[model samples]
Target: MAALEPERAKLDTTIPNESRIADYFLGGKDNFAADRAAAEHALTIAPELPALSREGRRFLRRAVRFLAGEAGIRQFVDIGCGLPTQGNVHEIAHSVAPDARVVYVDHDPMTVVHGQALLQDNERTVVIEADARDPAALLTHPGLTSVIDLDRPVAILLFAVLHCVPDDDLATHIVTHLRKAIAPGSYLALSHPVSDLCPEKTAKLAAVYQAQGTITGGRRGNLRTKAEVERFFDGLDLVEPGVVYTPLWRPGEETPHRPDATWVVGGVGRKPRRPREHPALT
Candidate 1:
């Protein structure tokens, strides 16, 4: 537990942390009064916030399963991973392939503390504290590099995290770095809140996050249009039904149907292998 002091120092009971607020939305016990209050405030602006959070988790589960089962990905770098919750990346991935390795990265210190505790016994998973916006540093972090080999096919999970990376240019840089690092056939699965879904309400939600302040290590939140979100998948081949609303992305029969207003768009895209060059005219 000595290693947790750094993250513990950053904890403030007065201001709600994004990860803790998200934990509250997911009905997890890892939150404080400030988080609950913030979530309640968000509800007044967008009553479906809780449901949207759940739908986001469902999309994450489905995306991870698809990567592990169908895409044959054995290693994962899940950036901006929040607090440990039910059906986490390792659990979902391991269910499909027991040998899969996962490294969970987050900027929130508490998330790293809790995540580390959650996966301590699981040899296949490790949690590290790092900002997702700096893909270069995160991708090269010793904790992540120790578990995932960049030369091999890997899946980078950005689910529900990109919106927290406010700067569009910085976001593009993050994706570009990731794209350049991963081997061909790697995947990027992301879910971002879109403005087009419910512009007025979503704007209010963004305002709520902005007012909450960035007590954590990253941006509060930023709602992007569906087109803006789609651009994150620029160099990859989007899977079927690309960048659709969360529940609409390859939902299983059991996945509950959510209203279109939920507005969080998600998709999984694979980096295709570059074609080999032919020999010069011989």
Candidate 2:
């Protein structure tokens, strides 16, 4: 709670927040006026923008189900987890394994507040208010320590958050650091908004977000290409059908196929267990 105080102090209604805007698009009531205005502006440019959000949430849920049921991952660190809504990470994970532990990380004060409130009664989950770029801080947070085991296989969920990280180098560094820091069997799941799908629409929507001062720290949205999105999985072994469009990645019967204009890509990868070196000949 003390650690989140700094993030709480940074909360302001004037600056629209990416998480809140996402919540708005997801049809959650956790967003404020600024976030609604930004989402409304984005809809004017792309009326199907809300579909993108829903698709992203579906990806997250499916990924969790796969990890918990198939991969046997009981611990999850959901970075940049936006406002908690129905079918949250914990709920999806625990649905498969009741003992699942989830640590949610986000820098938005309202997100932290809402997350804490929503998870207060859940003993196996916690919300840590911190920047996603600082994986060290997030991993070392007291809340995470209380809920997760760093040495055990865990799933790091970065759903719909990578585009908020503007700096390519910084984003790569963050993923690289987490890859090495967590256990060898750990997994990374990510979804990013790609600009190549509809360049003009992407630019227009980005401009609207920027003009609203959508406080994703300093970046607006940095959409990427499919190839560019693959870079985040450099050191990890991608799962089957790797790095495909969000709806196309292991689509379930209920997953709806979207047009190229949706532009979001997602994937899940595992950090391979490094081979041990043999002793020198005596």
Per-residue lDDT over 127-232 for candidate 1, one digit per residue giving the tens place of the 0 to 100 score: 9987765567788899988899999899999988777766667677777778767888889899988889678787777777866763322343447899988988
Q: How does model 2 score by TM-score?
A: 0.91
Clashing residue pairs in candidate 1 (N, C-alpha, C atoms within 3 angstroms): none
lDDT of 2 by residue, 6-64 (tens): 44327897778988888888888877888788888888988987888888888888899
TM-score of each: 0.90, 0.91
Q: Which ten residues in a row have the lowest lDDT in candidate 1?
A: 1-10
Instruction: Judge candidate 1 at residue 249 and give its lDDT.
Output: 82
| Clash totals, every prediction | 0, 0
Off by over 4 Å in 1: 1-9, 215-222, 275-282
